[model samples]
Target chain A: MTITTGYIISALLLFGIGMNGLMTCSHQLRKILAVNLMASGVFLILIVTGFGTDGSAIDHVPHAMVLTGIVISVSTTALALTLACRIQQRLNRSADETAEGNDDD
Target chain B: MNGGLTGMKKRKQSMKGKFKRKDWQFATLTSLLIATLVTFLCWAILKEPPGEDLTAEALAPLFVQSGVTSPVTAILLNFRGYDTLLEVMVLFLAGLGIWSQATVDPTNPLVFSSPATHPTKPNFHGPGPELILATLVRILIPLMVLVAGYLTWAGGFQAGGAFQGGALLGGAGILLILAEPQRISTIPPALIRFGIVLGPAIFLLVGVSCFGYGGNFLQYPQPGAGSWLLLIEFGAAISIGITLTTLFVGGRPDPKRLKGTDQP
Candidate 1:
């Protein structure tokens, strides 16, 4: 197979692995990692696709898109992490109260 | 009847051993499905021909018209400026979301004030590491700011741009916080808030100002396009830096909390 084809396959494999992790992983942190992996896989595909095998000039539009995508991805990830933190804190507080109630009993 | 049924079930279970478990069957089925899907996808991707690069020729000449030497920056800030504008808004909205969540339950203490003020990861503890870290930060923060400034300026003709430079500034801000988390808390809240909004506000103002000048939104008049792009980039870099740093800090920083805290 060609080198470009190899890169595409690798990208697809990463995307598949990330999808599987997203579907099956129970932990929220693991899910976030999976999402990032999937995003990187897509980014790789976009950049490689722009570099066509015909030896033509590189397309700058896709590069620009990827740059924008990178920034937006970080922002979304930050928001997701914040939500996860809040949820974890709430869960721990509830668990603590339950333990205290049981102790009193 | 119940005794006979239990005996029959136990005999069947012994015969089957562990091979017929439901969870195992489900796992195997899902694995097979995923394998088949992946195989199909790989085959399809490999079969497709790599198309000709049509966009490069079409966009190359237009690049110079955008008043930037780098084609990527030209496309981002000139040809498709709307997307970047929306992107800045998205970053702003994410910060706003986190800020709103911060105020949801005021009964609970602010994020860093709880007795359990530890982060999820094992943070630096003890005076030795703290002193080393503080010293390193003092050395690196100014250097990072200088690099960030260079990167923003270099973006006009090179691979770097507002995003990369802003990220560097944001990283420096995070490092400062890690070295002394309470230092940021001591800052006036109004200044912090203004810093966070500065990028998007300037970007919007530039776009709207174009309308009054009889140009389309975000369109620069032919001779002065370069200057406008530079102006927008500078404002965006500053705002982006502050927004990213705030996002990393998490929660809307309350001004009242700064009272009685020792200054750095």
Candidate 2:
């Protein structure tokens, strides 16, 4: 009972915080962190929701499902971050070359 | 005394505020629609019953007899096997995306020799490698491996599971990548690909191991559940570790080379 309540409250909080971060933050890393926080919050609620009805062993179904959820989240986040970094690298390089050429000219 | 580019950003922001407010109606409508859809879906899922699920109850034959405490393990390794397969696919996609982007392409748009990020410094910091940091990393790597194994073993009975253990192991690999980003190697890639396949393979193998006993893919007996879970988790650890490491290294500059400064 307590666990579910805790998860529900925290999940909402995380959702709000993540939304705020996504809205206000511009850096890619910060955006990822916010998204991750939101994910973790939802996952916690799901696991809590799985708590057994007649003491049937805290619903393994949700646990199992969330297990996969975590993996997929991490994988997608990794790929997104890589994309961001690549873009940053390109931007930095372009900016540097322009600065160098202008200095010489 | 000290003037950097930070002040320019603030100035730009304040200057743009007066000229802002271009698409207020569109932004508001889109955000409201998204919020409504998200909220409605979540409420529906939560309101759904406790026993009306086929996927949840069908496991009676495949797993969870009458009075069991850790049916959770069985659910993870067995019943919901297809979901696990899809999860592996996610990791595979992440790894592949990173792989393609990180790979050296001659025609890709990037500056090779911009003496800006990496001026002609010998080691960029101090030297080839600091003895202390290297030694610390050496000590930590082996410990992380042991921890990963333990997390895998503990998942069946405790809160630790394959994904958690696998991701942690993968974290260690990412740390290693940070040190040697430029010096690309096939080992990480191979390991990730292996990790991608290894987890499902072990999971399916153990699940099928129960088929002869008149059970399905992940059905577990009394004592075999623990052992079988251990095996699957071990495979999970390896796969997750490699795939995640590959993803990070693929995006960053090679440990030995800068991203924009390295030439083909």
lDDT of all predictions, in order shown? 0.76, 0.62
Tell me the tens digit of each residue's lDDT in model 2 across B23-58: 355445655664675576556545664554555556
Minimum summed lDDT over a 10-residue window in model 2 chain B is located at B105-114
| Residue A27, candidate 2: alpha-carbon lDDT | 88
Off by over 4 Å in 2: A1-3, A23-27, A52-57, A97-105, B1-15, B18-69, B104-126, B178-197, B200-230, B251-264
Assess candidate 2 and give its lDDT: 0.62
- Per-residue alpha-carbon lDDT of candidate 1 for residues B143-194, written as tens digits (9 for 90 to 100): 9989998888888898888888889999998887767765664576678779
Query: Please, what are the lDDT tens digits per residue for candidate 1 over residues A51-99?
Result: 7566677888888888888888888888898888777875777675554
C-alpha lDDT (0 to 100) for residue A65 of candidate 1: 89
